[model samples]
Target: MCLRGSLHGPSRCGRNEGRDLSLDQPLLRIERLTKRFGGVLALNDVSFSVRKGDVVGLIGPNGSGKTTLFHCITGFLEPDPPSHVEVMGESIKGKGPDGIALMGIVRTFQELRVFRRLSVIENLLMSAQQYQEDKIVPRFLNTGVIRAHEARAKERARELLELLNLSSSAGKTAGSLSFGQRKLLSLASALMPDPQLILLDEPVAAVNPVLIDKIKEFILDMKCAGKTFLLIEHNMGVVLDICDRIVVLDHGERIAEGAPQVIRTDPRVIDAYFGT
Candidate 1:
């Protein structure tokens, strides 16, 4: 991997590096991945794969290491040496967080992060910065180039907001919106990257039903258009309704893996949290 004058594609593999692989390859592959913080292993030998166009649910009670697994995948938490993580089948473990993001994996936080004072459209514009051209001098001096790119991203942002039913608020200040609106906006912010696999850390948590429905609709539409997702959620109804498959983790390990009904009936899942 080398950096010439500018960055290309996601990761540091350059623009054409991913062209050889099929578009439908399992968008994310984690193998024998282990992450330890000092003495204890937060995520012990966790392994999973997310294929294109599938919605996989990651469920577990608190302390199940679900969030830690996400951190490892997103490059927020590095794996112990001698391990590998591949996004769209390309090794991305050592690439660092931004590099991983450039590799076509994007996500939203459990707590929404956005430009509170900026307009909804402005928040989206900032999210699109990952794809901006590298020449800062040209961008600063050339008003035309900046305007063109800005307008283009704004148009795309409008489309995304409309998909989430936030189009009407496009010109409003992001901070002025309701809490649920901010949650949906956070999701829209992640999609600005056109990522292949999006890691959602509790997208529906603390959101009202209206915003929850909005998030659900957008996720379904993305799946229909061939996007992959591994969602971390506590809302059982939403998980069962949208997931093609479910993976349950408890106390830092996998407890069950199957369809929603099988998972619902599993004694282990019930005992883990629901109680016998």
Candidate 2:
């Protein structure tokens, strides 16, 4: 039996009452993850795990390899040999972006990836089509089976739009929506696949306080529905409120990791952020 709400707080599946997450294996794990860009060492032996149902926060200063870590994990960049990344206990070191995503991991970029010319719903439909079905014959033939699949995809898009409170903007051009709305749309698009673990890169960046709250609400709702997340956010307040455990990186190396409370008062964290 694992203790609840200790100084380190609960582990993965932390929010569940009286449940020990220790017996369960991690959903994602990395071992000695190292990345280098020519002469610059972007990441050196960084490691962490996001267990099932865990909302883990990844925080670091600028150029701390936080985004690079995300890229490596999602197959955007290859890590050096002997560096291992695993999803559900299987190695994903050499897998490409689509392959990793199909393996149940999806990520949202800090920079929005919405289609400017596409309608809000169209963008989501595109995401669904790309991942949900990849058969060339069904796509080009547009047979009854393919049409039914598309119908289901559109239905799922509507459901996601309603969930994210964007139902009214379904027909609007994605570029015409407010910046905050675009962010929400991007998040909805990422969810079109119903991915198991969603990696958010600064989900609340540049948004108003009201919109930030909405994003937070969406995350909490999904979490309650058994979705897991690994978030990279600079907003300390949001990180503290939403994450069960926080991991801090500085200069491309993991410097600290613990519950929010532990991270708040950590000496190394203060020094890293403040340079004191």
Candidate 3:
């Protein structure tokens, strides 16, 4: 059994053991993605590919376009023309955020986006509301399909709560939880949709050390279960520990892309972070 079983339950263990990680096509491809805001160019021709079942880290200085690139990919902001963001070989260029999310892509914000007044479980359930069948007639009739969907969503929410060590606080308001716990809640909310690719913005920032470790464990467990992640993180230790590859951005362009060891010693990365 996976070590995570003790904390995440046996049902979650070994689900992806021997799962193929070598898919021919990249799960997500960003080609010449650029974003401009009036007089400022936020992201200038950034490009990268995230493979199936891999965790890729996006790291750079504060204004290096990491979050801007995420915004462009997830549809919060449109990329300039001639730029393409593809998932499973299909272009999602003009799709809205909802469209992109339904395409099996979901993102979490750097700031906490949880409903402050809602309970932990409620927040998660709300995140899955987009997947519910909401036809007026069906909703009015309380159709079996809708009930079953609600049940499944609740089940998944509880499972994620346990996985993140937030089950004990399931009934508490999101605003009442500690900062670290709230961070975990945001992650749980992101997973509610069972997305193929999860974009996490500063997932571990400002989180306590213990919770940071817990978050890292949860991410590794999820990756082992065949999930792909593109994350923006400044914690190099966490990045090096969890990511299969690192992409370094500087001044809105990719300056380095390689394994963790290579990124750690790359002269360009060194200069970008430490100056000449």
Candidate 4:
């Protein structure tokens, strides 16, 4: 269960009591990952590691299996045998989406996914509801515990709204916000759980230039507070600016992986993005 603490502070959950938090092991590791749908290979032997405080970019042409890789990591899809997705060195095989979330991995979609009818704060609260202890008898007998949990959840939601510059629109319905604001809300909702690894899907895809800068600032702020991110984005400028390292994918295979400078000048990466 998620413990009540500052959103950007060190993890306070009991889940990590005996786990390794050493520098030698990465926060997330993907090994020999492959995914196939009806003989159409989505990912082939893809492998990478994300350190505890690095913002890594996954860049590739459209249909390069970026989203598919996200799905497999977040438990929306399972990888083929011999493929391993590990969080803090533990295999997450057979763990569904909910289970994976509890292990501190959260993601946002390529398409906006907000509760259209719900207020902005309400939407954030809903994202946190899954973590509440929901035992029927305990709920009836221990209303105080539930109330405490709710209060903490709201506090975190408001902090996120303020961090994302959406505090003024807390009472507004999600659908009423501008497209970029909605995208900000999606990111805020994902942060509610205070996950260790955040997988962002095209975070600045269609926003105005001003909002794109705002989004970049938000991500950088979060990074300073010790958040680790693995984002898929086509905006090379944004990726190069924010990412410490990048993994270039082409046709479901990892073509290159290195620092931003190295990736920028890599012939294979250049060829993949702009064919010869």
Query: Model 4 scores what on Cα lDDT?
Result: 0.86
Better of 1 and 3 by TM-score: 3
Sorted by TM-score, highest first, which candidate order results? 2, 4, 3, 1
Top candidate (TM-score): 2
Candidate 3 residue pairs that clash: none
Backbone clash pairs for candidate 1 read 10-102, 10-103, 11-102, 11-103
Candidate 3, residue 255: the lDDT equals: 89
User: Candidate 1, 138: how far from true, in Å?
Assistant: 6.2
RMSD of each: 7.8, 5.9, 3.7, 5.2
**lDDT computed for candidate 1:** 0.79
2 or 3, which is superior by lDDT? 2
For model 4, residues 61-104, the per-residue Cα lDDT tens digits are 99999999999999999899779989998889998888888889
Q: Write the per-residue lDDT of candidate 2 for residues 137-248, one digit (tens) a residue.
A: 7667868877887887787788778867899999999999999999999998888887889999999999999999989977776776577899999999999988988999
Q: Which ten residues in a row are the worst by lDDT in model 4?
A: 10-19
For the record, the alpha-carbon RMSD of candidate 2 to the native fold, in angstroms, is 5.9
How many clashes does each candidate structure show, in the order listed?
4, 0, 0, 0
Tell me each candidate's TM-score. 0.86, 0.91, 0.90, 0.90
- lDDT (10s digit) by residue, model 3, range 1-276: 232232333333332224565656899999998878898878888888998778899999989999889888888887897798899999997888888888899988988999999999999999998643346577658778778878888888888998888889999999999989999999988888788999999899999899999999888888876788899998889998888889999988998998888889989999997566
C-alpha local distance difference test of each model: 0.79, 0.85, 0.84, 0.86
Q: Lowest-scoring 10 consecutive residues by lDDT in candidate 1? A: 1-10
Model 4 residue runs over 4 Å out of place are: 1-23, 131-137, 274-276
